[model samples]
Target: MRGGNTNGPDGNLRKDVETALLRPNLTPWQRTFLTDIHARLERSGGQARLSDKQWRKIFEILGRPNNVIALPPRTVTAYPPRRQPSKLFRPRFGWVGRRLRWRLRNLAIGFLIVAAVALGQQVFNLGRGQFQSTPTSTRALQTQEFSVTDGDTVHVVGEATGTRLVGFNTPEKFSPQCEYERQLGERASSRLRELVAHGSIQLTKVACACAPNTEGTSECNFGRSCGVLQVDGKDVGSILISEGLAVSFVCGRTSCPPAPRPWCKG
Candidate 1:
């Protein structure tokens, strides 16, 4: 047998109440009263759920009480009761969930990138000095050759070495003595770029304690190293020197070529 409330005075009263609520052009206060009464009746009657029509009427009244336009109402008479929606929220739950998921994915990717960079830096700093003391050092370096710094230097990293071309000097591109020197420096830098454009270069690390904007300095004003640059089994320094693009420089034994300057006395 179907278990239900017997149609007594209480059931008739409940039916009357629902009918009144479901009628058109209800006043704001009357609609609110009907909804409250409906909720109380269901609570007292062992939570016997209302029909979709009844639930839809209550929701419409509460959500858009001013709208006179009739719309299809949702069923409320669900057994065990459907989850009540938030009173103030619009119906965008699915879109909200999807957007939140998308942003969470981007956040995860960002965290992964940060973690990788940190790991790489730690690996780089482990006992492999960026600027080695001499070019002839037996220990090899871990670096990827990038671009030439000037006529006699190139930039590298994996351990971040600022390597200078050993055995020669080029015109001062970084800090030129005169217009002529700057012009020559640019030409020298161009040639150097061409020479190193071939392959995964044989990397070396040598420490040079050079000053900023100076080609070769023992004083070490900037973080740089003196290292031999080779491209395709050819020494870049020797090429520049022979081609007259650069002048010879020997460390701790012979001096660099005479500076071309207004400061140099004739």
Candidate 2:
């Protein structure tokens, strides 16, 4: 006689057999029987019917105490419903989501690297005097407060240290290499004094090209601080250069070029 539906709209029998296939210690006969039932259910699309003997065998393998006749009105606990995988743990969007996240992380890392390099370059420039922002210190000088040492050097009234004006070089006056240099140095010094006589003298200190402990040596402008002198809002170096009293002298990243030899003028 035909028994109850094995694979039907209820699906309990088919699901129970499928659940039994997952048990680890099932005998080979039990596994083979459950697997055959699953295959038949798949082929018949849950419409497969079993005979009474087959129904008894299925319940026996599934560890259920009921036969097909006792299955209609009772709940089947032999196999519980399969738990659905949670959306949070499942890869819903597959590889696309993972790739996008990876790209965003790389972009953030790239931005940080670029910022670090730019900061390093700025520090390097500041140390070398190749790039500067505001002056480190500013001094206002009165006519009598400073004495012109030469065309480009000056000694302030109260300070023991002298200041060498940057951006221009004048002839040597302290120990001229030639008579022509001595004469030119005198003319330049006189002109510098004239320039400082009338207008506001402002000295803006800047970084000097010298090692940490070598301020008094020739490397650090011979013990003098480096400054930019502005008189009446005009750069003293620019004035001297325009009047042919001094030649333009600028330092690179490391140090200033050798002083121009105007002593033997061509």
Candidate 3:
């Protein structure tokens, strides 16, 4: 029969009343008790409020009637069961797709390495020729004696009968300027014979139209035989051009064009 006191020490009773009212499920007798407590607290002029500790205890007592309110032993949800990560998501693979990708990468690297090595070898071979020493004089051709026929022609005795000196065409013996051309040719031939008579001469056999065969035939025999007369290291054609006695002759070959000089024209 204790009436509620607004200014009195009823902190525990107010807590109990709040806890009982917050319960999700209550019996008929519990509901009536909480309503009566609430009414009594209202009449106390708003000074009675519940403490937290006493409210928790009263909440446990009032919630005992509901089995659902007992919180079902904190059961883990099985609706969205934790899926084990798929094997496809793993990076390690022994299949063809991964192996093919690895092989392609290795092939690309190997090709790049081979290309670099080939380029380096080519450059090394190109520069190797520059460091080689010049050839000795003993390796050069032995000189042969010759008689000067004219300004641009010479007669050299050979083991075989008729090997003509190439690269100059003198005027005909009875032509209008024959005397002048003959004098020039004789002088040129004498100078060439003197330069090559005792010294070694490097002869390079080239295909030429004016070269003669063994029977003195101007046409090609079974072979493409020709003559290039070189004295000391100078080409006889270039020497004749420098002396103004003979002009340059260019045969119409795949490599050489027609001679471009006024003197060479018909």
Error of 1 at 220 (Å): 2.4
The clash count for each model shown is 12, 0, 6
Candidate 3 per-residue C-alpha lDDT over 98-185 given as tens digits, one digit per residue, 9 for 90 to 100: 9988999999999999999999999887666434532322224544443444434433433222233455544322121334543554
Model 1 alpha-carbon miss at residue 205, Å: 1.6
Deviation in Å, model 3, residue 213 alpha carbon: 12
Worst 10 residues of 3 by lDDT: 64-73
Q: Provide the global lDDT of candidate 2 against the true structure.
A: 0.72
For candidate 1, what is the total of clashing residue pairs? 12
Write the residue-wise lDDT of candidate 2 on 1-266 in tens digits: 23234543345767888888999997665676678878987898765755333455677677775322423343556877899999888866668988998899999999999999999999988766632544454545787887787798877665545688888899865445666776788899899899889888787777776777776654566456778889988998899889877888888745777878676565
Q: Which stretches of candidate 2 lie over 4 Å from their true place?
A: 1-139, 216-219
lDDT of each: 0.56, 0.72, 0.48
TM-score of each: 0.38, 0.46, 0.33
How would you order the candidates by TM-score, starting with the best?
Answer: 2, 1, 3
Best model number under TM-score = 2
